[model samples]
Target chain A: MLKELDPLLHSQLRLGVMSILMSVESAEFTFLKEKTNSTAGNLSVQLDKLSEAGYITIEKSFNGKKPLTTCRINRKGMKAFEDYVNALKDYIKK
Target chain B: MESENKNLSPEQSLDLIASMIRQTQGNVSSGSFYFLLWGWVITLCNFGMYILAKFYSPSNAAFIWTLTIPAWIITMIYASRQDKTRSITTHLDKISMWLWIALGITILPSWIFGSVIDWRVNALVLMPVGMATFVSGIIIRFKPLLFGGITFWIAGTLCFIVSPLDQYLIGGVAMIFGYLLPGYMLRSKK
Candidate 1:
């Protein structure tokens, strides 16, 4: 009776983003891009997927003249992340 | 990293989480700047007041504290700039910011009602500062800051027994230990 790993969180980039979001209150798009070492386009796509799943919230605003995007994990995302980790633990234990 | 959709095994997933967390936690420079800035400002002001009170005029010595007004303005401007430039805000960062703000809120009232409160303002100020520093040390996991916080508390407690003039000198020394030393250590760590 082991828990199943979360499909949404099983991917590399999304998991990386979620992991970063778990430790921080919020992070800019550039920060996620840099930390994940992914292209802006790939990071943007993964971020949108996370947002669509309601795992995280993305806010688009202007920092001076430039467009600024910030991402934060919500309660659902936190629960999902915790569950994913527990599931990983279960798999490893077996 | 470019393989955005690459599926991870359980072990890889766990490793990724741990690594990302380490990366996120690695950026912790925001607190050091403020610690250094306040350390210098408060230490100088304390020593300035001691010098003035000891030699020039006890009556006008309190005027030197007004330097903090300019320091406060600079802090505000610097915070705004930092907010604009910083890409990430960690929970530890927010917690430390609010902790200091809560302590700061208490300080203004203590000064305004100094005559009525009748406690040595040094102790009143240092107690909260010590608490903030201690908690900040725990949050950042920095040993020097923990020692700094202890020094502040000890100096604050001594203020209860010492003369008004000597309190200034003790407080100045405490600032050197509590803020400046740890601040420099934290800066160097970065």
Candidate 2:
């Protein structure tokens, strides 16, 4: 059974972003930027795409005058991850 | 079954994920709280060693007794098996769990080699260990693990600074700060 996923999360960068977010309570923008090895512009674009898909929630705050962005994956995101993994496994199984 | 799947709002999604993580992680290390409760016993013994060493030749018996890497490893294994189901939440739990593991690994070698190697080198052990934990935290974006790793690195810093002239103090500090506090947090998360 295939679980339909938001198109936004399907791309490799977005997928990596979601995977990283799924593994933590929350993460800062700087941290995520470094982890995914994506430039700020690209990561910010992917994150906005994820947020738009309702797969994640983003909070913008300032840490000592510097902008701080933190993100957490939502329930839909979690299920999507499971469903996505399952779908991937299905392909492997075939 | 198809109807069971529905689009969730971000808040709802996060709630579901959080619950899944908790359900799967389901009390890592059954006796962790109890062991942590008794962690003070180790602290007390470490203190007793410090006191005794001040008055006598460096204490070996108590120093040897405080080696905890094996116990830490056993505890880690026990904790990891607590969750079998793989989910996004469970995956994150695995990340934090590995934080504790890397912390253990950081100090383990120091304890094993402290006697044979220069005590000065024992202090250096924290750099790689701390860096590993810190980088993992950054990569995974796990703040709690980051906090734990910071604590380990700070404790490691202390050990590195003082191990040359003082070993038991470092042990005592590591017992209280490194092991006891993080263990409490890991168990207390409900």
Candidate 3:
């Protein structure tokens, strides 16, 4: 029996974001965009979906005059990511 | 990356996870500046004091180590600048920073109190330094730093039987193994 893949994390961009966030304590919006190689508008949308699903938290503040956005994976997100990886492993074994 | 509708196979998902984790791990490049800076500073101070002790009065020789105060101030400035530019903060980074900060706090008091009590404290100071480095290595899973930490502990133990001046020499050699060598290796790895 194979575990079901996480709907929230099955897409390319969303999974990429989760993967990056899972490894670090926190990352800036720009950092995520760069790592994912996604446009700002596209990355922002994916981040919003992840944030809405409670898989991550987005903090918006100011660094001097410019707005700073940082994202961190929450407990739910970590568990979901771990489960997703385990599920992927089960699929790969078959 | 803009194709949001594409579904990945399990193999692709695993590959993505591995790649992202590698990318995040690669961001740990800023540590070399600190290691190199402090390594050179302390190494120079130790050797400088050793050389000065031969020709200068003891009081003058003691003043050489005070260079660390300015070096520390500069480190603070450099660290803040680096921090401002960093886009990611990992758990390991925070733990490593706090461990070194803890070392600084303990070392300062030990140095001052040792001087006041007329006891050589290089050996005493190295013990905590070893602990900090060892634990940091464990956090980062870096073997060189783990070995470097052990080297400091060994040097500190050997210091107990040596003269105060020789302790400076030992400390310098220890820093070479513990900080400079590992520091350079980390830089190259980056």
Q: Rank the candidates by lDDT, best first.
A: 1, 3, 2
How far residue A16's Cα lies from its native spot in candidate 1, in Å, is: 1.8
lDDT of 2 by residue, B1-190 (tens): 0112244444444444454333323322223352364356556656676676577666454453454445556555655543322122334445556665666677676667766764444345545555654555464454554664576577667775564436556645655654467557656764
Query: Where is the poorest 10-residue window by lDDT in model 2 chain B?
Result: B82-91
Using DockQ as the yardstick, the better of models 1 and 2 is 1
- Candidate 3 — which pairs collide? none
Candidate ranking (TM-score, best to worst): 1, 3, 2
Model 2 lDDT, residue B10, Cα:
44
Q: Which regions of candidate 1 fall more than 4 Å away from where they truly are?
A: A1-5, A90-94
As for candidate 2, its clashing pairs are A74-B13, A74-B14, A75-B13, A75-B14, A76-B13, B123-B160
Give lDDT tens digits, candidate 3, residues B147-185: 989999999999899998888899899999998998899
Number of the candidate with higher TM-score, 2 or 3: 3
Error at A92, model 1, angstroms? 4.4
- DockQ of every candidate: 0.82, 0.04, 0.71
Q: How accurate is candidate 3 locally (lDDT)?
A: 0.86
On the 0 to 100 scale, the lDDT of residue B28 in model 3 is: 52
Candidate 2's DockQ is 0.04
Error of 2 at B32 (Å): 6.6
Give the 10-residue window scoring lowest on summed lDDT in candidate 2 chain A: A2-11
lDDT of 1 at B187: 89
lDDT of 1 by residue, A5-94 (tens): 888898999999999999999999999999999999989988999999999999988867988899999999999999999999999999
